[model samples]
Target: MEHIEPVISVKGLSFRYRMSETVILNDISFDIFPGELVGIVGASGSGKSTLCLCLKGLIPHAIHGEMNGDIWVLGQNTREVPTEKLAVDVGMVFQDPESQIIGLTVIEDLAFGPENLEHPPEEILNRMLPILDKVKLQGFLNRETYKMSGGQKQRLAIANALMMQPKVLILDEPTSELDPIGKEEVYSTILELKKNGVTVVLVDHAIEEMAEIADRILVIEEGKLKYDDTPKNHFQSPEKFLEKGWLRIPQIAEALHALKGKDLLSEKYVTPFEEEAISTLSAWLGRESNVQFTVD
Candidate 1:
């Protein structure tokens, strides 16, 4: 079977601001399939945002930068395509939801994209309503954007981006400012997008949450791709990754790391939170004869 072309492809990518000598991204390369939900995780200055910016043609076009590489989004070479043109192919949601809102009312903001394409006004109306429903922001259509809560604002941001009907969506720390409920809402929205066949590239430091949603995880440290693997493997062997000191591991995994020497604990290392709790209870219940506790 022939392989279908990727939605986003990067090769030999490197970038540096005109004012700075340091390169933010090294010779990085990767590809995103049509419907895969991938997460890029790293420290503050690890170039997660920079790499994401490049996917949407924001690095060299919007920001003055020395860029050396090739990036293709929706089959168009990012280097040759204008940012405004790429906007139709790839949509981006930044860390701050407030920065994305523009029009006074939610419906108008959502309508902005299709209208620009000179789509028939009725057709724009047809597209806008469903997107509003998809994001569950229909009630806010006539309401003022400023009056909405932070979570509502973020959903509005997503609604606006979806209004464009882009094939790829790039989100940077999308849930960083959201509360627990808000974060869960955003994650559910992402899963919905994936189900609708949208390619999602999520950049955030929440490894556990990302692991639950992402099909693959790419680790970037000091502006380079360090480790790219399945979330299960990354967490299953904590010490191995900790030795690299690049990727972030879950807290439970870290606890398991420190318990490696406690023969019984090491024998049944847990993966997820529920698994850990059950394992601990089983060991303490005296179900296993070899299990024993000691004080140092």
Candidate 2:
């Protein structure tokens, strides 16, 4: 079998702000392969955002900080490469959509990155048109960005990032401030991106969303990496995460765990999706009492 190289690699990474004595990130390390959607979860002040910055080459370069260890994205050392150069390969969407939004209109915002890179007008249009449709903002091309809703702005932020044609994208709490509909809109966009083979690194407190979409999950605690495992494994033992105040397991997993404790569910059955959970439970119940249960 041939080995696949990771698109992003971090080794013994550590950092402390210039004037601060406290270490913001302890010796952290991980690898992200191409076309993977990795979710990062942690309590507030746990250095999740800091790690995103590092992946984007913002740490120790744009931010004043003392750092140790190395992070390589697409074979380029983050410390050695300028952020502008890194931006071409790794695009990042911040917690606040407004912070990254620079253009007055949707078209201008989507074109900003490529425009700065001096892409030809025709090439920029080719890139922008498809991304606008991909992000479901095709009709908002001439709309004033400031007048858009929260979800529209978030999707716009993602569309803007996509304009760079980056291979890897990192999002820091991209849906944190949106309403339920808005959150769903952003989540749909993320799933679409993953389906199209974009490597995504997402940091968010939306544990349910992570469970539903992430290929793998990383748990960060107090500037240290505590857990890196599949969502099924992490949520299988909800107590472990709940005990440490790290995450809330998806509701389906929570119910399944309780059923398993009562010896009503087999250890082999573990999932975060409601439809899967319902099917598993319905089959088990039917075998026990000839009951027929179906999802509506």
Candidate 3:
């Protein structure tokens, strides 16, 4: 792989709510490259959301916190840049869709960010269609925000963030409140955003979906950056994370892991996706019953 330059870099970052408060992040540091979809998971109150806030310059700036170390986003120091300026480069969507949705109409919601930055009407209009298409909200541009379903509202919130065309997008538990179908819609949109070279930081409990979408996983434990590796490796060593009381790999991957590198299956199956695991098992069994196993 070619050396991709990091778009965001954190140097020895640590933060706490106040002098008397316990540290939420403890000397955490990492680099996020352009177009990378990074997934963060941990037990609740492990400083995951605080990390997101730090990335977007909310730490020690808008939110009063005792912060140490530096964060550089888009080649600019986040500590130096104003929150308004950082907002332009890093688009953030909170866990709750309703909290972010301010406009009565979809068009108004989508245009909210741009209008704040004082983007002209024509320029905003030109950007609308493309963004609407990106999130699959094309025909509902004029629909009422409250009338939309949980999924639609979530996508609309994402669309609102995309209106700025920010370099980085951070989402906190985007699908926590959505139904299964709503989760699928939001997950699909996240995958599409990765394809478009948008750096995304997702804090979610959907480990299965993370296996499908995240290029790399960042596991946090007690306000520390514990594991940073490809999802493949992360799932392969579930025992380590489990021992630390961090997170478990997807169920599908756990099933495959039990059979991985075993002669019982013709192929060494270690994927986390459900459909892929099923297919791999079927093919292996077919090879055993029908004919001799031939290496692909």
Candidate 4:
């Protein structure tokens, strides 16, 4: 087997704001490989956003604070590299889409990053064409940026980041403020990015959505690294998380777990989606055909 290098690596990372005794992050360490979609979850104030800032070279560079340990992005130390340079390889989308927008129109917004990089107009147009389509905003080129729906604004923010052609994209609660339809729009774009091989680190409270798309889930609790495992494993014992208010289990997994507690399920099953739940339940029912069952 070939060894693949991690696109992002953090070693013994710890941090706290200057003049503050409270530690925002404590001895956190992890590696994210190429083309992986990893979800970071925890209760609010778990330092998830701070971690995102660290990954993007904002913590030690732009934000003033005491920092320990090292973070390497594409093998370059984030501490050593300038944030502007890091922005080329690492893109970030914040909780509010409007915060990242700077252009009056969609095209202007998309061109902002590359334009600053001094790319020619023709080259900028070339870059925007494909990304516009990727985010499903090709038809909204001339549209006013402020007039877009919540979902559209978020997609535009994503496309703007893609204009930089970053190798790693970190999204912090991108769907928190959106309607259901808006959330789905952002989710679809994220899945599309994964398919295209862009490594993503997402911080979100939508556990069910994360279960569906995340290759691995990293749970943080009170400035500590709690769990780093696949969705199935991380969510298998939802009680442990629910009891502490760390995360919400996917509905299917929660239901399956409840059934298992009553001995109705012969084995523990963690289902993140309806289709998988259907298949697993059908198989179990087939084996229990001889046993009579009553539905309350």
Candidate 5:
């Protein structure tokens, strides 16, 4: 079997609306490899959505903007490629699932992409049934999309994207609309996608959750790419990105920060699980038995 290069690559990418002199994205560059789950994060209006649009070929193609630099998906330059063609190489799931969903029913929506691509009916069905199961929507395939919960609707949007079988999958705040249970379901789904060797790019404000799933994390600030590193390193220096208010700080970091001034809180507990956080703090406090806890 032949090896494939990165599914998505962006270099010196910058964008701004025609009427505005201010740039919404500036000198952003990143690469997403096959089977890697990468997270993009920043504060509100930090150009997260604009960057996503650019990556999806919607910035210059569908939206009017002054765009600069090169974005390559599946080895094709996005500047010269139409979204319809890029759709085969890259799939984008927006924050609002309702905005992306158009089919009256779930199965119809899932089939829309494959149908447009002129995929044979048998082949489409071959791929469809397994994907529905992958997303845990097996029984809901024929259900009306409007009747589905926010999380289920989001899954439908993802199914629509997956129907394309693109090399790269981009999700913008896939869990922002979900309740706690919904968030869990979506995250589990994402993990399944990663296991299937799909390149994943996630744009979200939920830092801790992303950390749990992402192999690499990139922080954008005022339209500029700032920090690019593994989740472990990003959490080690959350303050650097946290200062800009665009990066998501890990939950344990937040808990530790909240318990500042106590020696027990200074120990590292990077995982997302609450049990790990408690256990680490307990051990740290136990080690300092000689030092009594004094309420200030």
Candidate 6:
């Protein structure tokens, strides 16, 4: 089988809000391959949001900041590429949906990104329906944008980004403001995007949710790239995260850790899902039911 190349690459990346200010991203580097769902977790002010901005070519183009690094999304250097040109390949949905949305109706909002790219109206109409359905917004095309609930607006924001059919989607804290149902809708859309081979970068404090879906996890702290590993590997050694309190282990992982403290669990057992943990516990209980041990 042939190896797939990375779609996004960063090398020696460092960014500061101002020339004299403290660095937000300090010499961090990583790569994301196509069709990967990557999660970024960190405390507030740890540069998770700033890194998202850099991924989409907005740092030097739309926002003013001191940047020293190379960021290539879909093979174009972010520093040299125009934001408009990059937008064709990268779409970003922010934490606040209202800030990025401007159309009066859902259809209008979905049409904005495509229309600005000079796509004809008929072509846009042809593409809009399926895109709305992708986000589970099929019946909401004519609804007023402002009147939709928080989750709906967030999904619409994602739909607006998807309208352009970008190769990579960047979502910054996309589910932070949503309730459980709203978060479920948002996360389902994310999984669907991944299924369709669109690269996804999600930044959020929802570690449990990320552990459920992310192909890989990146933990940043104090303007540095701290841990970049699989979710299972990262959580197996929770001390790294617990030491600084920059990241949180999923509650399910905590329960499993507690189980491992006893002699029932294998010394090498590791998993992040509650269902898997339950299965393991059930099997252990069934086998141990016939055996009794005396305390030493």
RMSD of each: 4.2, 3.4, 3.3, 3.4, 4.5, 3.2
TM-score, structure 2 vs. true:
0.91
> Which stretches of candidate 6 lie above 4 Å from their native place?
1-3, 262-264, 287-296
lDDT of 1 by residue, 204-244 (tens): 87776787778888888888988777776677676767787
Q: Worst ten-residue run, lDDT, model 2? A: 287-296
lDDT of every model, 2 decimals: 0.81, 0.86, 0.84, 0.87, 0.80, 0.84
Which of the two, 3 or 4, has more TM-score? 4
lDDT of 2 by residue, 1-296 (tens): 98999999999999998899999899999999999999999888999999998999999799988899999999999999999889998999988898899999998888888988899989998888878887678788899999998778888888888888778999999887778776777788889889989999999888887888999999998899989999888887777876776577787888887877787776556578766777788777675433354422
Clashing pairs in 1: none
Q: Which residue pairs show collisions in model 5?
A: 42-246, 43-246
Candidate 6 lDDT over 178-281, as tens digits, reads 78776877788889889999999999777888898999999888889988999888877576676776567898777666666665455345477766666666
Model 3: weakest 10-residue lDDT segment is 287-296
**Can you give the lDDT of residue 227 in candidate 4?**
92
Per-candidate TM-scores read 0.85, 0.91, 0.87, 0.90, 0.85, 0.91
Clashes of 1: 0
Model 3: how far is 85 from its true place, Å? 1.0
For candidate 5, write residues 1-296 as lDDT tens digits: 98767778899999998889999999888888879999988878889888888888888999997999999888889889998888887899998899999889887888888888788888988888888886678988779988988878887787788888777889999888777776777788788879888889999777767888899988888899887888877775466755665455876866665565344444354444455556656655665333343433
Stretches > 4 Å off in candidate 3:
1-4, 146-149, 243-246, 260-268, 274-276, 287-296
Q: After superposition, how far is residue 134 of candidate 6 from its true place, in Å?
A: 3.2
> lDDT: which is higher, 2 or 6?
2
C-alpha positional error of residue 266 in candidate 5 after TM-score superposition, expressed in Å: 5.6
Candidate 4 weakest lDDT stretch, 10 residues: 287-296
Candidate 2 residues lying further than 4 Å off, grouped into runs, are 287-296
lDDT of 3: 0.84
Error of 1 at 112 (Å): 0.7
